[model samples]
Target: MTSTRATVDHYERLAASHDHNWTHSGVFLDWMTSQIVSAASIGATDRVADVGSGTGLFARHIADQVHPAQPILCVDTSRPMLTQIPTSPEPQPVVAPAEEMAEWVTAGGGAGTAGELDVILLKESVHTR
Candidate 1:
């Protein structure tokens, strides 16, 4: 198993360059947007939580698919990655670890139940979870 410390270190190291690479890569951006849009369409009204939401790319793409003003939490352990997310006067970004996600939701008055999500996007970071 990958230790928590190691995982954090790995992500922290990569976070700085992740956004740059993704931003310039058209293929990756297209694929990510497609995936997020598809996921959002299936779970129309529920709040979405994106784990390892690096730079909020997927989260931002799916924002319009959700309710006009519903919340979407973007969780990432790396502050640098979170900082790189494109600014949107619309969707907000939150920086936190994926493992602590349940607490973050409950604190926001959500049910905190597994599979209760209308949409839970793991994206390309599922292996980290």
Candidate 2:
């Protein structure tokens, strides 16, 4: 497993350029994210958590499917990466490792029970950790 500190350091270094780099994903990202959201059965009442949320690109896209109050938890190891997430109504940014994602989810007013999360999304950010 990757050490949390190393993971954080690596993402911190990349945070500034993350959005630009992600632009290449473009239409593919849109299609992939749509499929994931549809398959996950995410709804307005469901509490969604985007693990390894990076700059919240996927989180924001997924948020569009849910209501503003549903909340999309943006969990990332690097604070810099979290900060790169554009200001949005649905994404609630949390600086934490993937293992601690549940804790952050509960703290954010989610159901806090196993299998209670509506969606736990991991884009290209998981392999780094």
Candidate 3:
């Protein structure tokens, strides 16, 4: 069996290519953005979580719409992927595994500002878990 650390390292490498592949498809991003925006109203003061936020593409877009008041959390197992996110004043990015998110939720850490997440977006990373 692969060690957890090795698995994480592997994902970090994969993340480097994630944006190149996903962002190239404009249609996919547009569809995803529309869905995310429609489902989680951009202006709503909600606690949102994005799991496997590869390169933070969707998270960044959502943050742009939501702005400073709303809290958005970008969680990903890949450190490299998390680093690529723009250092903007909006959403905050956290390096973590999707399955381990409950710890943060229970402890009220990172993106768990108010309490439980109002919206949790898995995106295309669900099957990986």
Candidate 4:
């Protein structure tokens, strides 16, 4: 059986390339992302969590829609994947598996002035849930 740790290690190894590969998805990704963001109706005061946030593509996209001070927690099992997120307002990289994300957040991982997450975008991570 494939263990979770082994899967995480694989993602760590592929983090950089993962970000690069998303570019090839092209307009499909952009359109899908736009639809998600639009439907999320994220407010400036909303705290957001992007679980399984590899390279923070979805988190980065939503950063602009949320408040400048609102925290966007980027939780992933792979540290290398979290590191791939480009510098922006401020991306909180929490290294943890999807299963433990709720506990981590409860322990103040993603807590901001606005409190807990108002919006959470799981995207391809639905399986993890």
lDDT at residue 119 of model 3 (Cα atoms): 83
Clashes of each: 0, 0, 0, 0
How do the residues 1-129 of candidate 3 rate in per-residue lDDT, one tens digit apiece?
112766677767777676776544777666778777887665557778888776788887777656636657788777788888777765677777765787878877653366577788887673442
lDDT of 2 at 63: 75
Instruction: Give lDDT tens digits, candidate 1, residues 8-106.
Output: 777778777876665547676666666666646645466677787877776776665444345566767677778777666534466666656766555
Reference-based lDDT, residue 122, model 2? 78
TM-score for each candidate, following the candidate numbering:
0.65, 0.77, 0.75, 0.77
Task: Supply candidate 1's per-residue lDDT for 70.
Answer: 58
Q: How accurate is candidate 3 locally (lDDT)?
A: 0.71
The parts of candidate 2 lying over 4 Å away from their true place are: 1-6, 23-25, 103-116, 127-129
Report per-prediction Cα RMSD to one decimal.
4.5, 3.6, 3.3, 3.3
Stretches of candidate 4 exceeding 4 Å from the true structure: 1-3, 23-26, 65-68, 106-115, 126-129
Better model by lDDT, 1 or 3? 3
Clash pairs, candidate 2, are none
Off by over 4 Å in 3: 1-9, 23-28, 40-42, 110-112, 126-129
Question: What ranking of all candidate models by TM-score puts the best one first?
Answer: 4, 2, 3, 1
